[model samples]
Target: MYGFRFEDVIVDDDAAADDLQAHLADAHGGKARPLCMCTPAGVPMYVAKVGEHYVIKRMPNTGGTHAPDCASYEPPAELSGLGEVKGEAIQENIEDGVTTLRLDFSLSKTGARIAPAPSGEAADTVRTDGAKLTLRGTLHYLWEEAGLNRWYPAMAGTRSWYVVRKFLLQAAAGKVSKGEPLGRSLYVPESYSQDNAAGITQRRIAHMAALAASGKTRKLMIAIGEVKEIAESRYGFKIVAKHLPDFPFMLSEELHLRLQKRFENELALWDSIEDSHLTFISTFGVGPTGIASIETLAVMVVSVNWIPFEHAYDKLMLDALTVQKRRFVKGLRYNLAENKPLACAVLADVLPKPVALYVQPPGIEQEDEDALSKLIGESDIPSWIWRAGEAMPELPLPSHDSASPGSSLHRRVPPRLSAPMLLAQKEGPESAW
Candidate 1:
C-alpha cells in the first residue's frame, strides 16, 4: 500500500483523508498542495478532491514509481507520443491549486472553404513538425491526458464511451489553445442515453451555435470522438461518431474516399485489436441548422490499452505483450504524407536501453531486406524484429546498464518504402505499414 506525504510527514491510508484536508487548510490556504504525497520510493504525488474526499494522483513523470498493481500506476511516458510534446507542444503550469495546460495547436482556423482532395489522395496540409501538435498527435495527447491509455485488471468491463467522454471533457477544461481556454473552442458531444437525450441535444446546439453564427466566413473548430461508421449518403457520405449517435456528420465523397485510403493501415489495426477504438479529429464548420460538417480530418486506431498502432502486426504484438503486463510505447506517424518509416513500438522500463520492436511486411523480396535492415540498424539501442510468416523470436534481455537514465529512449523514425516498392500480391503501402 502507498502512503501520503503531508509536507515532511508521511501518513497512511487510515489517516490520509483527514490529515490532507487539515494540511491544505492550514498551510496552502485551502488550495491543493503541490506534490504533497510521496510514494514509498519518494516519488511526488498530489491530492485531488473528489466530492468531499481526497484521492492521490501521481506527479508528472513519476508514474512509474507506483507499483504496477496500484490504481494510480501508469506506463512510462516513452510508451506514447506524450514524451515528445511534454515541454514542446504541451506545457503544464501549476498556480493556486489549479493545473492548466498551454497547448501549441490552434482550436479554431479561419479561412475560405477548403476544397476536397481527389479520391484516394491526401491533401498537402502543413507538416506535423514545428512546435504545434499535428491532428494525429492531438488525438493521442487527449487520450493520454484523459487517462484512457492507462489500464489495470480492476478496470475490465467498466469502461465505456460515456465514461470516456466525461473524462475527456474534464481533462480538456482549463487547457489553453489559441489564447483561450480550450473548452470554449472545443466541443465533445455528451454520451447518448435515454434519460439525457434532450439535454445532450440542447448542449450540442448551444455549443455549435458559435460556429453556425460565423456565417460565410465560418470559423472551423476541432472535434474529437470515436468513429462508429462511414457510409454513402445522398449529399455525400455520413460519419456517425459513437457518442453523438443522433448527429451524423456529413463528409464529401471525395474527402471520404481520401480518409478511407489514407487510414487503411489504421483501420486494419483497429479491426485486429479487440475492443480497440478508431478516433477521429477534424476541423469542421456548423451549418445554419446546427449540423456539424468536417472540412479537414484524420483518423487513428488505438489498442484496448489505448496505445496507438499502425498495422495489424502491431496489434498482435501489443496484445501479446500487454497480457504479460509488460510496458511498451507505440509509434506515431506525424507526417502522414511523407514516405518515412517508424518502429511498431518500444518496450519501456527495461535495462541498457529500451527495446525497439519492428515488424517487416510479409512475403518480402530480396530488396526489402536491405531496407528492413537499414531501418532497424538506424537504432543504436538493442532492437528486435518480427518478420512476416515467421514465429516471433524471444526478446533480448536488457544489459546490466540498461536502467541508466538518458535521452536514448526518445522516438526515432524508421525507413519507409514507396508505393511502387511493394509487391503486387500484398496490401498497398497505405494499408500495409
Candidate 2:
C-alpha cells in the first residue's frame, strides 16, 4: 500500500525498480523540489542514499503515518526515550541520511576510577536529568532505530547473528559518541557461517589482537553482544556471547561479584523467563594474552518479541498484551531507576492517545505514593494503573473492530491516586515479589 511520488508524478506500487530509481534521481538533487515517497495515504518520505544505492526512508517525525503492517510503521513516539530527546539530543540531517546525536555521558573515561563499571540497571540511578539519554539509553536507541526491535510473524527463525551484525553496523555509521564516530570504538564480530567460518575467526582474532595491544593509557572500547552465559573460571568468570561462541570475555572475580550484586534484580528477572535473552553492553579491554575482559558493563533483558523489559511486572504485562495480538511500545527507563515513577508500557493502536500503563510496585511506601501521584499528574496523556495488591485486572482492550483512521478507544482517565495500591500479601512471610 506504499508508493513513490515525485514532481506531481505518482509511481504505482508495482512500478519497476529501474523506473523508481530514475524518478528518485530526477527529483532535484539537493534542494528546491525534493523527491517524496509515501504510504498510499500520502504520508511523506524521503529518498536516502545508503552506500551506492538510494533507498526510501520514512521522513523525520513521520513514522506514525504508515499502517501497522508496513515496514515503516513505528509505535507512537510518546512511548519511548526517542520522544524525550527528539530535537535536543537527536538531530537528523535528512539531506545526507545521517543522524547527529549529542550524548551527555562520555564513552571513554580518563584516569582511573575507584569502582569498576556499574551494571546497566545500576546506571539508571546516576542520571542527572530525564531529558538526556544515558549510555545504556543510547544503546537502546540504536537498537530501536536500527529496526531490530520490529518483528513480523514471517521473520521467525530467519533472524541470525549475521543479520544482527549488519544492522548494527549500519546503525552505528554517522553516529557520534563523545566526539568520536561510534563505529571507531565499537566492535561487533561478523557472524560465522559455514563457508566463511575460518575467515571470520581470523578476522575476529586480528581485532582482538588489536584490542589486546591497546595499552592501559588507551581508552576502553565498547562491545555489545548477547550474553550466552557467565561461567566460573580460574581467573574469574568467562562471559560467552552468543555471536562469538568460541571466544569468552573475561571478568575479574572482584568485578564479576560486583556485577552480580549490582544487577541481582535484573538477573533474577531474566532467569525467570523461558524465552528471553540478556544483552550486555560494556566497555572492555583485551589482555596481553588476547583474553578480553569487561571494564564496566550494562545488562538488558529482551523478550521473545525482541523488545526490552525492566522488571517481572513488565514481562507479565507485555506477555499478556502480546497474547491478545495487541500492539504496544515498551517504555525505557532512560535515566530513571526502576523504583521511579515511570509508565511500564504504552498501549498503542487504539486510543484517544496511546494509553500509558503504570504498574505499581508491590508494597509501596509513602514516598513511592507521592512519586507515583506526581508522575501521574505530570503525564500529558491518559493513563491507567495496575496495582500489585489486587488480582491482575483486565487490561483495557484495544478497539480493533471499531478502529478506523481516526477512531479512538474508551479512554480511562487515570484517577487522582493517593493511597498505595496494595500488594498481594502472602499470609505468613514477607518477601520481595
Candidate 3:
C-alpha cells in the first residue's frame, strides 16, 4: 500500500477507509499539499473532488518523479509520443482540474452535403502539426488517461467492457474538446442486457440527440466501442460495434475502401491474433431517417488484456510480460511515425531503475538503428532491445537488494524543496511538474 502525507499526518492506503476518506476530504481545497510518499523524496499530489468523494491525483507531468512501483509512476514522456504534444495539443488547467484539447478535425459540419475527410489515413504517419491532435491522437490520449496503458498482475481478468466504459467516461469527465465538454459528445457503449435493451437504446438516443438535429449544419458525436464486424450493407458497408448490436453505423463505399487502405496493418494484426480486440473511434451523425453514418474513423488493435499493440512482435512481448506477471506501462504512438524510435514498453518493477523495452523491426535500416541507439544513449533509464529476427532476451529480474539500507537501490531523499517543484530537468523550461 502507498503512503500519503497530508501535511504532517501520514496515512497508508490500507488504513481504515473512513480515516483515509476523512483525511482526503480535509485536504481538499486546503493550503496543505498532499505528498505521495512512494519515494524517500515525496512526490507532490493534489486532491480532486470526483463525484461525492475526494481523490488524490499526481501533479501534471510529475509521473516520472514517483517510484517505479507506485500507481502514479509513468514512464518519462520522452519514451513515448506524448513528448511531442504534451503542452500544445493537450493543455491541463491545474486550478480548474480540466484538460483542454486542440483537435485537427472538426466536431460540427457546416455544408448541406456531408463529405467526411478520411481522417483515419493519418494513423501511423506524422500528419499533424504537433499543435493539434488527430483522431488517432485523441484515442491515444483517452486510452492513456483512462489508465488502460498500464498493467499489473492483480489486474488480470478484471478488465471488461463494463470496466472500460466506466474509466473512459471518468477520464472524459473534465475534458474539453473544441470548447465543448467532451463527456457530452463522447459515447461509450454500456454493458448490454436483454432485459434492459429498450432502456439502453432510449438513453443512447437521448445522449445522441444532438446528431439528429435538423439543419444544414449538422453536429457530430464521437463513438468509441469494440468492433464486432465490418460487413457489407445494402447501401455500402456498416460497422457493427460490440454491445451496440442494434445500432450499426453506416459508411459509404469510398470511406470503406479508404478505411481498408489506411488501416490495413491494424486489420491484419487484429486478424492474426486470437481473442484480441479491435477498437474503433469515429465521428458520426444521425440523419433525418435515423441512420447513423460515420464521418471519420480510426481503429486500434489491442490484446485480450485490452493493452494496445503496434505489431505481432509487440503482442509477443506483451504475452511474455503478462505470463511472467511483470508490471509495466505499454507505450503508445500518438502522432509518431513508424520510422521514429520510441520505447515499446517500460518495465516498472525492475531494480536499480525501471527499464525501457524497445523492439527493432525486422531488417531495420542502418540510419534508423543509429537513431535508436542515440535515443537509448540519451535516456537515463536502462533499455532492453530485441531485434525482430533474433531470439528474445531475458527480462531483468526484480532486485533482492532493494530492501538493504545501504544498497544503491535504496530510495534517496533529495533535499526538501518547495511544494510542487516542477521537474523541468528533462523536458525544458516550459515543462510542468
**Alpha-carbon lDDT of model 1:** 0.56
* Model 3 weakest lDDT span, ten residues long: 415-424
The CA lDDT at 294 in model 3 is 90
Across residues 73-120, which tens digit of lDDT does each residue of candidate 3 receive? 779998998988899999987665678999887778887565555563
User: For candidate 1, lDDT tens digit of each residue in 341-369?
Assistant: 45666665454255677777576677667
TM-score of each: 0.70, 0.77, 0.89
TM-score winner among the candidates? 3
Per-residue accuracy of model 2 over 1-433 as CA lDDT, tens digit each: 2344565777743576677667666652634343233234466666666555565556678656554433455555655555666766777777776667776554444446533556445454454354556667677777766555543323345455555555666677767655667776777866545776777678766555545445446456778888889899886798898858777878778878887887787688778888888877777766567667677777788887566877777778877776765655566755555566667776655443556777876888889989878876866667788886777777777655324443212211111011000001112321111
Who is ahead in lDDT, 1 or 3? 3
Q: What's the C-alpha lDDT at position 163 in model 1?
A: 59
Clashing pairs in 1: 79-329, 341-414, 351-402, 352-402
Tell me the spans in candidate 3 whose CA falls farther than 4 Å from its real position: 15-21, 113-117, 120-125, 401-433
Those runs of model 1 whose alpha carbons end farther than 4 Å from true positions after fitting are: 11-41, 44-80, 95-111, 115-126, 215-217, 268-275, 304-307, 325-389, 395-433
Candidate ranking (TM-score, best to worst): 3, 2, 1
> Judged by lDDT relative to the true structure, which candidate is superior, 1 or 2?
2
